[model samples]
Target: TAGDTAGDTAGDTPEDTPEDSPVEDDISSNKKGRFHSLGVGELLVVKQKLIAYEEGEIAHIENVMKGEKRSRNHRTLHRTEEFTSFELEKEEETKRDLETTTRFELQKEIDSEVQESTKKEAGLTVTGKYGPTVEFTANAGIATEKSSSKSKNLSTSYSKEVVDRSVHRIQEKIKEKRTLLTIDEVEVINEHSFGNLESVAEHTNGIYRWVNKKYEAQLFDYGTREIFEVVIPEPAAFLRYLATNHPKEGTSIPKPQKPGYMRLYPILGTNEFEEVFIPLSPGLLTKETYLKWVEKYNIQDVLPPPSSFIVTSIAFAIDPVDTGVEDEGDGSLTPNWRTVNMKNTELVVPPGYVAKIGTLSLAIFPLHRFILRGLFGEIAIGTNKHAFHQGGGIGGSETFVLSNETGLVPVAFSLTTKQFFSGTLEVQCRRTEEHMEAWQISTFNAIMNRYEVLKEEYEESISGEELFGSVDIQGKNPLENKSIILNELKRQVITQMTRQTFDEFDAMREGVLPEGFPQQDVDEAWSEGQYVRFVEQAFEWENMQYLFYPYFWGKKKDWPVNSRLEDTDPLFKSFLQAGSCRINIPVRPGFEIPINIFLSTGEFPWDSGEGGIAVENEDGEEERDIFLSIAEELKAQQGAVYFKSDGTVFHANEDLESVLTGDLIEEVNDDGDVVLNDDGEPVLINGTNFLEDDINREINIGGKIYMIIAVNEEQQKITLDENISIQESVQYGIGAKAIGVPWVVTVPTSLVMLHDGNKLPEIPEAP
Candidate 1:
């Protein structure tokens, strides 16, 4: 009774809840995290360490006879008292009880928590933690419950079961082969793909899910870089079967290796004639030679434009890029934290730009409420959070134990996407309501902190809001209400830097000097000294699109996007200090447009170890700067529309208008009018900037009025419908097989005869 000083609530202990009192109960109930069996080599190593630390030479150090010039000390006291230490008896006993009660409780977790103790391989030595401290390894020489044995056993069983099930299901599907599916049957397939990843028989229309599983979604390309559409009797059911079924050994279900994701769309009804928008797995819908196509195709701007990531915000903090902040210290609050302000951080990652956010960029954009209200679609407020809480203790103790007065400060805002220009987007914002108390475990002693509730409640009730809806086209800045996908209580540096500048820009324009930092005001005006040229060029540049800032980047195994980072190095350092941490990734890149941005980790190509951005292990740290470089080159398609349809017809800018119709009349360049030579053939413009490769060239195809068509690599012919061409009534289509995917060559004007009868057979065929 004396040791139990508490209000009488029983049946469990270590309460893991916000609503529950500090001692409400059952907290350690789910403490199990990781487990692994011991290897023979590892066992020997541990045993050696324990022996050395225990009864080895050091045990009788000073006791060695004082002969010659060797031993002078009286006693080199033995630090090892074996596994049972009388000093730590009380807590050790309690831990033992907890494990004996729960058989599955893993020693790995204990080892992780207290490394020095459990690491030694002293045969059957009690792990000081009490009950299961003496966890055995399969290679422990004698009878020991090795963690590897359990893992191997389970893995083998799972594999066998999967094989058996796949065979059984295939047989079933074949037996029940049916004909044209009805709409009901089709929708079922669609719905299944939405959920089950391996359900072969459960063909789904579209494989849509909280694939990010969390509320948010990130868009990614399928293998082919296109919005792939494989039409089956029941698109949904087929996809479902594909998803729910397991792949055979040695073979895996085709998946994006680096990104590990793909967005799928469903084809409905028995319509072989239907053409659905290919979802972006690329190859499915990735960018190609758009230079030749842009003016000719008449399509809007492209998604995932290239550019650098810069920070502009009000809640700015500036620290040496090297310094990192953490939980128990003043790193976060260091005066010189932000380099910019908050509002200024709101940015549009320009088309053709990839903003690589360093920690400083994030510090400027901390936990501000970013409200995204589209007049054309769903309106909501959210912040992608690098999860933090203003509470005590390590885990969620300080977080979840909150007073009934409030909810968590950081809550989730899930959203649905609409066609953004010609692309899709996943949008996350900064948090708005800091006062909102999340889950808490409050009692006579304390209350659950704000952030804890969010961690707990995220999995279940996040979908309460109607994440989707259409919008009314009205205002100019319709998405005005600021909803930050990442929210923080304090200011980041970038916010400060930019805010000062913006305010100065406003002041100078109005002929008024604000209070502090007059030079900052002047500098702000100076940074934009080139504003005219930038704006002019921006205006000159075509369609513009906006993307959210980087909130959190992580692996798929991480929880929902919870962790926050200000600068890359610092944020990473902070994570390193946290031991084994699991941050949220907003984890969705499919179904939504890239509302934002991944870290350089295990999944990325240039990783040294599992999830090692800073290279805690290994050498040869090759940075993955090349992939982004490639994507950039691909996005900036720089060439004229090469049309090799009838012959070598090249069109650029306005010349591409109504290109497929009749003789394409153009205002040619005076230097070389893209005209025919004296022999009535294409006069090759040697050394033109238009050609990236001498052998291969790109050409635009479709247009609003008339599109350009080219001929195949081998065949020097392009057949057009009688309506399109004035010469012959040929209904043949244009084919250019030589122009391998992406890079294409346009046909010359002579090959395609005009209705008005203008013909110049000058251009030669594409080699």
Candidate 2:
């Protein structure tokens, strides 16, 4: 109704509002004298205008000061002109600052207006006969561009026929869900429920094979027949024989009468004088005095001497009747009655070992008896035949190295026996050697001997008949050869041995060595190449012991080491590169081993018979059906259009019904001139009216004919009513008559492949 008169403002002359005035002279002259010449009515009008402006209700402004009278003197006018000139300059600066401050405030009001207008809820009416007589209005929830003579409306309700058609379309879409070949081809059959389910063959057995390719590759790379071993002394040994005799030759020593003891001859070449004794007391002589004794007795002249001439024993008196014999009243005693009790006995020297008189203070059955107290204490020396190899190198495997025939000084001495079945044998014999060597020559000799054989073999292979053959090597000793090849071999051996030793020590320190190994021996022998190489080879073999010995019983077996006259490539070079010994074993190719053993005994591991547990269907047919149903529902939703509450007519992928009301679709700038793309095609703007290609055609709108104008594919907007004169241009919103194109929304099925009983399937051929 009010819109019928809205066009009048465009042509009507401006009129003065009450607010289009200035201030009164009395109030303005007090401070702001710029409005000092205002009348009473003008003052009220200015006050009202200022108040309305501040309240944000000011709608229109009229030419309030236009065609008004003015009066000013020449001096006041000159002063005003000067002040205006200065104020003009200052205003330029102030305008920049004011623009920044008011920009956000002005933008907020514009944004709110745009949002409110987009709702298109408010009604507009142009009550003038110059425009169209019929007033078409877009209902709500759909904003439209400003139009004078044309409008469009989307229907809020559909006819019963339209609803029935929509329902039929939805059902058809659901029926189309089963047409998908992917879903149709999927096996929906469940596993057999009652029969022998375990016997029902499976596609996959669920066994994961972890094939050790690295081990296989290293096992059969280089030399397949060569073997290497590092020689080391036995961990435990004893004096097998007393003289120049061998045990295997049938001259074996008689077994001891009692366990944990050994009897020795006190005199040389005399069996009757056999007794565990030494001539000198423990710690009786110092190094200087023992050397003097050596000069007096010529002890060093003999390779090994009898124990009685040098070592002294404690003479125990035995009664003549103690041997179960009557005294006969003759007062004579036989030697047989004084049998030497070697059990838990101690001597100044060890049997079968040469000693320089008092040089060594030995003990026997040291654990049970307190013999040679400090020298052979439980804490000092543990389970040993001699004190020489008691500590330091090779787990206390070091031998003795005594300079001259130095005697041992007695630091402490004791020998007292207890009654039968009363106490342990007590013999405290603490000897203080007046001498000790820095580096024993015997220890050096032992270490050198370890490499001597290897060195000789290496030299022979390099320069002997194996290599020289008919070539003249007569003038040169192969063992003494200093050829380049031998030197290189020596260098490589040294480098490899050093690296292997370092790795072993590191492993030992880090506790990465095999369980129960002695880290002490490894640490000590790490510097000696012979022992270091030995440990390295032993450790490497131990790691792959599973492959060598199928039924190993946790026993250390000697690796066969033979000197090779010819150079051969090792089968496994990778192990050698890793500073590990290559066992020179060849692996058979294409050997397939089962990942797991299935011990089938005509029975399932878990019972599935009738009195036992019931087995459900293994295949997941129900889950597949559920997923297919979900896909059908989502497909049905594709046809359901959502009318936006924000009044946005054009939505992405949305089909709209509208009538054409414009000439043709074309891109237009702010001046409304047709724009063109680079291809010379008319660019179509969105949310604008457009007509079909045939502009002369008339389109039916609500059974009324409207001239078709243009068609806009980009905006999907159709223009109509080209003949009808519109006072302004506006967008024809949703509901215009247009062709509806069918669309379907499909999604990928969220189906997962499962094993029997809906279990997560195990991956095969892992690692």
**Could you tally the backbone clashes for each prediction?**
198, 39
| lDDT agreement of model 1 with the native | 0.22
For model 1 the local lDDT of residue 274 reads 30
lDDT string, candidate 1, 240-311, tens digits: 233333332223322211211243433457333432333222222222332222222233433332212332
lDDT of 2 at 450: 34
Candidate 1 residue spans exceeding 4 A from truth: 1-557, 560-702, 705-767
Runs of candidate 2 exceeding 4 Å displacement: 1-313, 318-426, 430-440, 465-594, 597-767
Count backbone overlaps in model 1.
198
TM-score of each: 0.16, 0.13
Best by TM-score: 1
For 1-767, candidate 2 gives per-residue lDDT tens digits of 10011111012212222324431111000110000101111000000001111111122221213233234332211111111111111111111111111112111111122222233555555444546565544432455553223334443432211100000011111111112121111112223222223444343322122111111011111111112212112111111121112222122322211111234544657544443524332243433333433443233332211223233333222222222333546864322222122222223332223343222233222222222111111211112232231221111112333222212211122222211111121122222222122122222233333333334334334333333344332222322332322232333332332222122223233343687554543322322333332222222121111111111121122122111111111211111112222121111111101000001111111221111212233573322111113343343223211111111222222232233223334567899888889998788644333334434333333334443455565544445544333333332322122222213322111122222332333445868
Error of 2 at 293 (Å): 36
lDDT of 2: 0.25
